[model samples]
Each structure stands twice: as C-alpha cells, then as structure tokens.
Target: MTAAEHLLAAKSFAELRGSYSGALFIIASGPSTKAFPLQRYADYPMLALNGSICCLAEAGIAPLFYLCDDSSFVRNRLPLLLQALAHAQHLALSPRVVGSLLAQEPQALDGRSAYRFERVNRLPEGGEAMSDRRFARQARKDPDFECDFSWFRQKPNRIGFSRNLDKGYFSSRTIPYAGIQLAYHLGFSRVFLVGVDLDSSLGRFYEQGEQAVKSRLDGDYEDYILPCFRLMAERVINPGFQVYNLSANSRLPAEVVPKIDLDQLDALLAAS
Candidate 1:
C-alpha cells in the first residue's frame, strides 16, 4: 500500500490530529540551544528535531514528541534516534525510516513509539502557486522584505509554494518546519522555538566536542529557510496563532517570527 493508504488504514492516525493543545516548545539542534534555560520550560510540551535529542537527553529533558524526516538521520544516527524514540511518546517520521527501523529491530513499531508516517505529493496546487507569486512580488520590491502573510488570515486552503508543507504535510527544507506544522495540527496555539539557529557555520550543539558532525548549513537562505517561515507566518501566525523564536544567535529575521529571550519566558508562560 502507498504511504497515504497506509496512513488511511491506520486507526490511530486520524485520532492523532489535534491530540495536543496549549503551549508547545520546538527544540532544534543548533549550537545556541545549549545555553537555553531548559529548567524554566521543563514542564511545557517539547518537540525535539533531529540530533537535538542528544543534547536534551544529556540535560535530562525528555521531549514529548520527536520528529525526523531525513532518512540520513536513521542511517548515520540510528542508535541515538532509537534511544530518543524509546523515550518520546510520539514520533513523526518518514515511512522509509519506519521500515528501516523495523528491519533492524522487529519490535521497533509495535505500538511502543506512536508512529505517524509522512505522506507527500510533489505537485503544487493552485493556491500554493499564488502564495509563491505573492512572495516573489514582495521580494522584488525589497530584497529582505518579509511578507505580511495576512492572506493566511483567510485560511487559504493551501499556504505557499516552494518550502511550505501545506500540500501533503511533507517536510520542506528543514525538519523543524514539519515539526511546526505538526504542532499546529496538534492544536497548539502558542509555540516556542528553541535551538533553531538556522546558521550552518556554528554547527549543532549536540555534535560539539571531540566527535562533531559536519554542518549542513550550505543551502541558500532565500531558497531554503525563508520560504518555510513565510508559510508559517502566513498560515500559522497571521491567524492569531503564536510562534516565538528563542534562539539568541538564530539567523532568522525578526520580521519572520519575533524572538523572545529565555529570561522573558516566565512572563510569557504566565501571560499564556
């Protein structure tokens, strides 16, 4: 069966929608995340992306959800990935990853780690094309222009082209974008992003020290990162949903999503 058919066949998949509410913290594997005050936000639900699990594990912070779409993650870091999966209540991953895991360990997906396999369609719908056109127009006016994304207020059936995950809930350029979409689908109104540095040069915090992995920040900002945030700003934030960036050294522009300091989190949580 196809991935979509497999998803449709799974009884738990539909029920997984909107399974979580209230505030959410997304932890990406950036170098700056090492300094985040994890003790402050320890109580909130967190979604760990990629190798961030290693750092969170070291800090004794168990994430509620773990999301990884890249098959390379499984190939290069299967042990770490499985260890995270064993702890996470839910896992959003590609079907290929699931297959690979089950092959190595037969009991990997035996209802132990709630698995939600990804389904995607590469072709763009008309609405996505329009968002792309609109973004392009705005970019032509100003190179660093950030789209108002008010169009998302109308609840466009689709959000954007290029890097947006609206079409099939497929991963765009980064795993965190997919994590953001999953958070929204899980009914989270307030989302806080931690460790999303978006800078490739600094490398990942988890990979630091003697055995460091090479940075994957070679992609162009306009072609990869900005489009994903633009979609989130439109589809997720413009409609009154909140997303805050907590990475102090993050390369994401403030106009895309406002950044909040770790010290300010107490006030932010109380206000929520």
Candidate 2:
C-alpha cells in the first residue's frame, strides 16, 4: 500500500478517545529498558517509542501502538523504522515523520494501521511564537528547524498534555510527552513509563558507538522537559489518571512521577 492509501485507512484520534480502559506501558529507548521483563507484561498493551520497538520485536511481542515523533530518526533509521512498522499493530506518527516517509519511503507505511498527529505548542492559545523574519531565515537554512524560544517561559502552564489529540499533542523535544498524551487519549487511566531515564549522556540502550542518535534531552531539559513534566504532574496525575515511572534510575525526580519497582507494578496490576 502507498502512504496515501495507508493514511486513508488510518483511524483518527477521536475514534480512539476513551476506547480503552486498561493500564498501558510506554516503552522508551533508555538503557534501563534492557532490564525490563517483557514476558511478565505480554498480556497488557504497550506503546513503543522510536527504536524501543526493537526490544518488543526481539521478545516476539507486537506493540499495541508504535509512535515516532522524530523526523530525523525516520530518515536516518529507515531499516529500524521498517522493523517497527512490521512489529507494531498500529502507528502514531508526527506530521514531520509522515512527511519524511512520504518523501523517502512511502512503502514503509504499507500494510499497517497508521495515524498522523500534529506537533503543537504546549498551550492552545499561542502557537509557535516565532517572528516571520526569523522563521523565514531558519526555514531557508534548515528544513527541519522548528524551535523557537520566544514564549517558552511565558507561563507556568507552558507545557500541555492534550485531552483531545485531534487538535494535537504538545511537544517537549521528547517523545514521552507525546506518549503521555496518546495514553490519555486512548483512555488508559494507569500509565506506566518504561525506560524514560531522561539522561542524555548515558545514551540509549539500543544504540552503541556510531549507531547512536544524538539526544537533545539535556539541552531541552531546563526550558522544555522539566517544566513540561512538572505541569503534567500538577494537572494530570490524579486518582483518575495515574502515571508511574518504572525506571528506578531515571533522572526525573520521583516527586514529578512516582517511581515503582517491578513487584510494586505487579501489585498495582493485580489490584487493578
């Protein structure tokens, strides 16, 4: 199937809203994920982010949904992306990634349930607040340049977790933010984050030496990631919507997201 054909068959975010009522585990590419026992959680749904799909693929388990918000990863790691497509039952791709696949490898999205999502600002009121001249200059130099620091620190609620993904998902220069929004939209009240270590220097568990993709997490932390998650915790984490961090060594403080061991996770699942 062509990319267009796959997109035509893809389900909208609205269609998935409140469609599920179970716990969800969001798998990231952090090194801590290597220790995660996929066998124990095989019965539950999992969302694989970027190269983390390889972990599930290796374990012979298909991800309930595969999400890739980075266009560069799509372009530089076509083989891995194709592997993800093969292992994922459904895909949630950012507009930029879709454009990259449409340009370079439309056939990669073939024979899969795929959906496209927009990357919007943290708040609905103000979009990316870049000046026209600056936007034009950046656009002229780099097609992928989309960052602007104009209104990043304007408010405490700068980071948004979209309840309605049809509008878009807030981007924090990290995939987990989008994953969180996707989980919420899918009606997963209990969200478990697996392998979101958030330390750029440590690198990803799936990549080694030259195969590693450069991480922007460290640089984006102060301005984007920290504030984003902080607001997310304050506004989103509640009895109705609980988020737990499975990575014990994660750089994110337990205050923002409570850390849980495997036994605790099992207990929570059993109780739920």
Candidate 3:
C-alpha cells in the first residue's frame, strides 16, 4: 500500500481507548532480554520495541502491538523494521517513522492496524534561556522533529506522563515510555516492562559491536529518562494502572518502578 493509503487505513488512538483491561508486556531491547522466556507469554498480548522483535521472532510468536519511536531505525534498519511490522498485529509509529517507511517502502504497512502519535517537546520549566535557545535552533534545523510545543507555551512549562495519548506523549529519550502511555490508553490494568535495563554499557541483546545501534541512553538517563519515570510514578501509576519491571538489574531505582521476578509476576497475575 502507498503511504497515503496507509494513512487512510490507519486507526485513530480514540478507537483503542479502554480496549483492554488485562495485563500486557512491553518487550524492550536491553541485553537482559536475551534471557527472557518469551514463549511463556505466547497467549498474552506483547508489545515489542525496535530490535527486540528479534527475540519475539526467536520465540516463534508475534507481538500484539509493535512500536518504533525512532525514525532512524526505520531508515537505518528498514529490513528489520519491516520484518517486525509483518508479524505485528498492531502498530504504533511516530509520524517521522511513518514518513521514513513511506520513503523506504510505501507498501510496508499494507492491511495493518496502526496508530500514529506525536511527541511532546518539553523545554526546561525554569528560566533556562540557553537550553531554550538551543532547542529552538535544533527544532529549526531538524525537518523530522515532530514535537508538540503546546506545553512549552504554558505558564509553568510543565512536563509529565501523558495519561491521554491522543494529546501526545512525552519523549523521555526512551521508547518504553511511549509503550507505557500506549498501554494506559489501551486500558491495561497491569503493565510489565521486560528488558528495560537502562545501562548503556551492556548494549542491546540483539546486536553487538559494529552492528549495534548508537545509544544516547548514558547521556539522557539522568536528565531525561529517570526524571520522566519519577513523574510517571508520581502522577500516573496508581492501583488502577500499575507498572512492574521484569528487569531486576535495571538501572532504574526500585522506588520509581517496583521490580519483580517471574515468580512474583506470575503470582500477581494469578491474584488478579
């Protein structure tokens, strides 16, 4: 299908609101994911991110929802992205990713159920004049920068977790945050984050050496990623929308997202 046709076929986020009321898993590309038992959740809905779909393919299962927040991956690794999209039951792509796919392979999303979401660009709340100037310059230069600056114009210039995805989602330098927001929009009660190890030294489980994708996690962790999770913990994650981390060794503090082993996860699921 052509990109225009794909757009015509794409479903709106509003259609997905409150569609699911059960537990779901978000598979990320952390090195620890190599050990995750994906087959155990074959019957359950799983959301795969970036190259993490390789793990799902290895388990001979397809992801219920697949998201690629990075357009660079679609440009640099089109084959892998296409491979994942072929097996994914649903798609959640940024506009830039869709544009890249349109340029690379207009027919890629044929007959697929997809939802497109915009990213919220957050400028520092305080009078960080230098940072604001830098961001303005970068936004002016980058053609694919699809940031919703609506929050920036507000009085306090606040940034927090997006409970309603149709408005837009905050980009925390990690695609997992998008997945979590998508889960919330889909009405999931319990969300499991698998392979969310924030350590950049280990690299991804699916790629190594020259084959690995470049990472900005080390630089973005403290300033962007951690603070975003803390905001989510404070504002969004409640009994109704509980989020659990399966990656025990993740760099994220336990207070931000409670960590649990598979046994604990199973018990929680059983209890629910």
Candidate 4:
C-alpha cells in the first residue's frame, strides 16, 4: 500500500475514543518499564514495545497494543508476546517483522479469539493470500537458512511503512515518529514517554533483564539517538501536542520537562 493508505489504515482517534476513551498510555519497552506499578494502570489503554510486552505480560497487565520494529530483542521474546495476544486489543507492527510473528503462528494463538494483527504495510505483490503457514513454509526453503524479520526498519516518514527507500523527516527516529503517530490518532495534546531509557548496555536493552546496552560510537547517544529525536521533536510535535521523556534513565536534558517523572505532569493534568 502507499504511504497515505498506510497512515489512513492506522487507528484514528474517532475509532479509539469510540472504544477506549482515556489517556493515550505510552508504554516504552525499556527494562525500566518493568519498574512502574502496572497494576495501577489496569484501566488505561497502553502501547507496549517488545520487552515491555514481556514485562507487561508477566505483570498481568494486558496492554491495548504492542509496537516494535524487527529487532532481535523482539524475536527473543516471542512466546511471551504470543501469550499476550490472547488478551491484547491489537498487535501493531512493522511489515518486515511480520514474518517472525507469522511463523510462530498456528501455535502462537491457537484456540484464542482472533485479535487484530495489523501489519504496518500491505503484503508485497504476489504475497497476497499468503497465510502465516505458507509464508513460514517458503522461508524454510531459503538457502541462507535465515528468514528472520528483525532487520525490519520503519518506512520513511509520511511515506508509509513499506517503501524502504524514501527517507522523510522522521524515518530514522523510530520512537518519536511512533509517538507522534499515536498521539494524533489518540487525540492527545501531550505524549508522555514512560521508560524510554536509550542507554544500551551490552548493545542490548537489559542487564540480566535490568541492564542497558552500551554503544561503542563514543558519543553515539548524541550522534544517533539525540539528533533523530531532536529532529522529530521539532518537525512532528504539534503546538498543542508535546512529547516528554518520563523515565528515570531518560538522558534528555531539563529543557525537556518531566524528563524524569510524572510528578509535574500529574499536577498539570489534574489542574487541567
């Protein structure tokens, strides 16, 4: 599908409010997300990433939706995710990663009611009618013995999720792009990020499940994550809608308020 078609297919505020009307809960899959008192949030609709999905599942907190690119982290925790599918409202994913989730199907969600399994993009030409089993079977024939989908990258901004070559403003900035898209669709004036710890220890997302991944690019934090986020913050965040990082490990400077917590946000929301 085209970019417009992809964006149009995304859930909109009207449909969401018609169903779940409340704060647009942004659940980052960072290890620290496991720290939140999730039971306190049983009533809110949440969008969780891969590891956070695992943590959320273990905590008995059913998220409204799960989001993740085709990173290895996502692949490592498939069983946990497939388990949550039985309860989650939807599983929002990029196109490239669909293979991983599809391959695990048949068993991943057997006997469970059908939940929304949305692929961010349309299936490629000739990929139509390709059921989960058929796709997996084809992968079995690959000579390279590699059929994983963790290499899936988000499509360029406003260009849809399948066009791999077009780089819009937010193509490289995964977090903010998704946040903005979700905020617009959820009708939120502010997007608060909980557990957005970009610190990569061991070049992964957890330390014994509590650690962070490290980067060798000496200032990769600045060179990579920051520039992309800054660009997205400038181009995407609307005047009425703002994005704030609300994690204990958030490295965003004070210029970005609630950079540490929701104390101030709670007060503001309460007053409003």
Per-residue CA lDDT of model 3 for 114-219, tens digit only, reads: 8876664532233233343344344434432322223345311223466666656767889898899889888999999999998888998877789887789999
> Sort by lDDT, best first: what order?
2, 3, 1, 4
State the weakest 10-residue window (summed lDDT) of model 4: 160-169
> Residue 107, candidate 2: how far off, in angstroms?
2.0
Count of residue pairs whose backbone atoms collide, per candidate: 0, 0, 0, 11
Quality of model 1 by C-alpha lDDT: 0.66
- Model 3 poorest 10 in a row by lDDT: 142-151
Candidate 2 local Cα displacement, residue 173, angstroms = 1.3
Q: Which stretches of candidate 1 lie over 4 Å from their true place?
A: 1-13, 122-167, 209-211
Clashing pairs in 1: none
lDDT of 2 by residue, 1-272 (tens): 55545545666888888999879999998999999998789989999999998889999889989999788997788877888878899889875677687788756766668877666432222345544344434433432222233324443333455676775666777888789888888899999999999998889998899988888888888877877788688866789899999999998999999999999999999999
On a 0 to 100 scale, what is the lDDT of residue 230 in model 4? 57
The lDDT per prediction is: 0.66, 0.79, 0.78, 0.49
What is the lDDT for 219 in model 2? 88
- Indicate the residue-level lDDT of 228 in model 2: 75
Model 4, global lDDT: 0.49
